[model samples]
Target: MSSAFSLSSGRGRGAARLAAAALVWGLATAGTIAAAGTATADEIPQNQGGATATIGDLKTYGSAVIHENGEDSWVSAGLFEMSVENGGMLQTYGVDLHSPTQRDARYQETSWNGTSLSGNAKAGRIRWILENSYPQVNDLAALAGKAGVTGLTEQDAAAGTQVAIWRYSDGADVDAAAPQAQKLADYLEKNARDLAEPEVSLTLAPAAVSGRPGERLGPVTVHTNAGSVTVTPPTDIAAGGVRVVDQDGRAVTSATNGSRLFFDVPAEGADGSTSLTVQASTTVPVGRAFTSETHSQTQILAGSSESTVSAAASANWAAKGAITALAAQKNCAKGGVDITAANKGDAAFTFELMGDEHTVAAGVSETLTIPLQEDQVYDFTIGGADGGGKRFKGVLDCKTQGGASGIAAQTLSEPSPASVGGSDGGTDLAETGGSGLTPVIAGAAIALVLVGGAVVVLVGRKQTPPQV
Candidate 1:
């Protein structure tokens, strides 16, 4: 992705610097960097400064009784706030509720600040009190008499549900409560189920292309088949010099995180076809460059079966030529020298003008206009198949005309006559000096050696003809 803001010229430099400074200042003030808002279960951040924090969405679970006539439910409330403070201190806070609904639920807020929990002592105390006292003490008067707490019990009675608060001063006291807290947290997590959300699937149409090296192929059309959802175009899709463009011939931004391209889907379902364009870079060679997308059904529920489908499109390059020619005035002053090179051959060939080299295909021509100094000399070289599978090489040397507006043109020709050899009129044999008879003599020598060895073997096995 390109920069969100460009400081290409000096005009925007000051504004860019100010924006960066403001961003840093905002982060420093926030104390913690979080995603935009309160994160969902899957989006919660974890492992902050050696302490882990997890937040689960509130959901109703198992039922219980608080009053004599009214039924109450137990909701395991896990840690809502947990942090590792400076100097290796750990702090945690949580709230548990027992009632059928939030309006009538009895809640207790508890906090602990310490190094570690001791054993199950505090957890046992809490569990025992809730199991033994809560069911029997149906009224506020009985609950206060049992716990020996007066004002808090009266307040809970007025509110119609009990409320308890606890804070541990010593590390050992906090340690005793850890096991029960963990148990409650686990229970809540196990009971909570995710709500279902709409699913979206994406499909990319197949693309095939054949072009010569150094030839730009596209804007090739790409169609997107979206499943029951409105899908947006990818933000960026340039990978390995391959570019994606829109219908207007403008490039579309795309991320390169993986072969799978992700596009935003609107809440309302997208069921129609969307089209884009893909272009292959000129430098791509004779082969296939493929871009793929794998789409999976989005699941809102935990432990749901996931299904994925993948599709790929390829840009194929072949042995062909693409060339161009143009002439223009340079600097609106000097008359430029326009040189054109056309590939009259059947296949792609490499053309070198001066020191620059380009690949040209059959029936294609390339023209270059060079700002010239009078009498300047330039050289050219062309090599590859010409026609009927015959390979050829051509070279040219020309000088610019001595005056402005003067044109000097010449057709390129083979600097040397073709000799009988390979298709390119060039032999693949290594320069070993001796004539082609070298391999023949070597083969004969090897044959004689083999025959002599065979004879020796026969004589050794004869044993004076054995039977005479």
Candidate 2:
């Protein structure tokens, strides 16, 4: 998403710029895990006492500009461009300014491009122009006194060309004074023919955010930090989706483009502070099982710093099981058999019993007394539709009361087939059976057969007695 904020000129501009620079540096440094080192200064070159040094008296005028160029995922280069008007001045005196240090400790030198020098400098480093005129120790001392600056010292007072140096343990001090120093440098460079400083412009790198991965099957939230800015909806936030609100719970206006969310916060508060709120949201498909995911990325806010935040969301769906019971009444006062069907799942179902169709809504139980002949079996079909448009079909074998009858209930523990007219394809059934007389009659028949076999064996033995 594209978001822009206005950086009001004046005092706020400097603070906003500095904050932005800090933000860029923080983002760049966050990826590098190394031992911190103390700042040390390199020895300055000394002028050897010799014959009157012949300093080139060439007049010079030029402009220096700085640009920000991103080089990789974790690094960006700040480039400086210098353009001089006179060719002779280029050979006489080169520009001297402190620049940012690169990831590599070696200082990068500017290459000549048709009388113009341009090269990459360290990101977020402040560069200051030093005096390059000869025999100006008295003038340098006076200027330092006027400016109330204490770091200035003349490096070579007797050389034909004067060189002044400012000893700094680190770039932090220079950065603190960069805004005011820039104004002075701009003015002097514009008017002074013998001295010049480059005009510097900084572009901060975009905030690198760690985005959630996998499929976020529902509403998901993503967050990151932008220096002093605090991100809400911490990592692994599951509910309420993603949203940005002020202290009063007032929603901040925002727009989302694809996976990126863009919003603006005031560059500075009424008290000259920086504060803003932002929220982002996206929808993902949920599956049958629970799915957990994380989102990470880098975001760049206009006129602000880059921040990286990661959030997690878990997508879950309920696994439903139908609670069903089949009740049968045999030899009722007036009916063949009473059948009842109950549904406890969150879905309505349709059932067919003894050629009668019935509808059973979710969490409801329906009972119907149907007349059927004794010892006769009938097809009792039940079907229903779930929330996902899937169909379920079940069948029960219903028989009227044969001998003795009472109420009986059967519980179903499995899901029905997902098609109409589909049999259970199993022998398990819930039904009332005939009386106990069937077993007794079968026993009597077995006894009669045994007696007949004994009588036949005795007659055969009597007929064969003479042969023995």
Candidate 3:
């Protein structure tokens, strides 16, 4: 009873060849579909703007004179750049830009990630100067007098202010070259307040993607500026479970930069997709900046701050997508498209193409003709606009430039061979118990299939082969 197989009689129409071919074809294709069950990661478009930035006038903000092993050196603290990556300038200050930045390098924004509580309040205290102290407040005269120094040259005022900022930004016991500037540095740190860390330092690409109940779509990669992260995968009833899945279908609740993720829906689940949010406490990587979409504007806020940053990613899991185009030309200059489509995969749906809407029943086949004047009419994408149903995609193209060309249509997704139901050799399927074989029974089916195939091939060598 554990291994039971029924032999179908190879009595008509090149039955032997059909038996062998079916056995081989079914096993081969079923293996393919099985392999596909594992997660496949294809690149999804990232969610980032064309990185850009615009620089402001750079002036002397004073300097930091550091005493390392009894040696002193000057570090400039002059530049303040801002762009929230959201079309607004947030009045930012430079925390760690030791690297020379070309003002024209505003568009060099690339590679960012997420994080949680990274560093202590050192960077926050430095930002405090930008908010409540000297250059931020624009009262150099008052500041110089408070620090108890005379002849606070404009450059010295700038340098001294910068020096004080470096004290916290770099966690160094450095002071301004001008003794007065040192007092100024001391005063700023004394009153500096800790602001909450930045909440954004990473990006998840591809705002949306479309898939059906039985397909794995996307290689949703993570772009982060942080060192570590904890991912909160999208939650939905459509998915049997709610953890973001890895290539092996394991739940990935935590990950690092460049971590590739995919959407794994059960072969039987309905359509549903939500958002994937991740949080982290880590250092904003050095030399990373935000890009702009509208203009060449950006901010240089790398290696100088710590934060608990978070980001979310989402995609669309539609019931249908991927339509193929077909074309036929009456002459060199005229091409007409015939859309032949059917749907039982879902409810009734409509497709919008070439300024027309064609509604089709879910279980019925429909065809629509749209003529084209081939004055170089090329590719056409029949957009799937209707919310849910068996999707019908149509594509067609005609070319008159070189020679004769015809548009060919194709099915974007085809039901597996195992799902095809039909009559064979004028035999009654109801009486023969004929149906596709599942993997569990494929081996037994093959054993019986080979015997019938051998007999049929021997009998049909002289006759024409039948198409299954």
What lDDT does the true structure give each of the candidates? Answer: 0.21, 0.21, 0.39
Q: Which ten residues in a row have the lowest lDDT in candidate 2?
A: 287-296
Residue ranges of candidate 1 with Cα displaced over 4 Å: 1-203, 212-216, 219-240, 254-306, 316-468
lDDT of 2: 0.21
lDDT of 2 by residue, 109-153 (tens): 111110112121221111222232212224755544444444433
Worst ten in a row by lDDT for model 1: 291-300
Best prediction by TM-score: 3
TM-scores of the models, in the order given:
0.15, 0.16, 0.34
Give lDDT tens digits, candidate 1, residues 224-266. 2222212233233322233344444344553121223222222
Which candidate gets the maximum lDDT versus the true structure?
A: 3
Better TM-score candidate (1, 3): 3
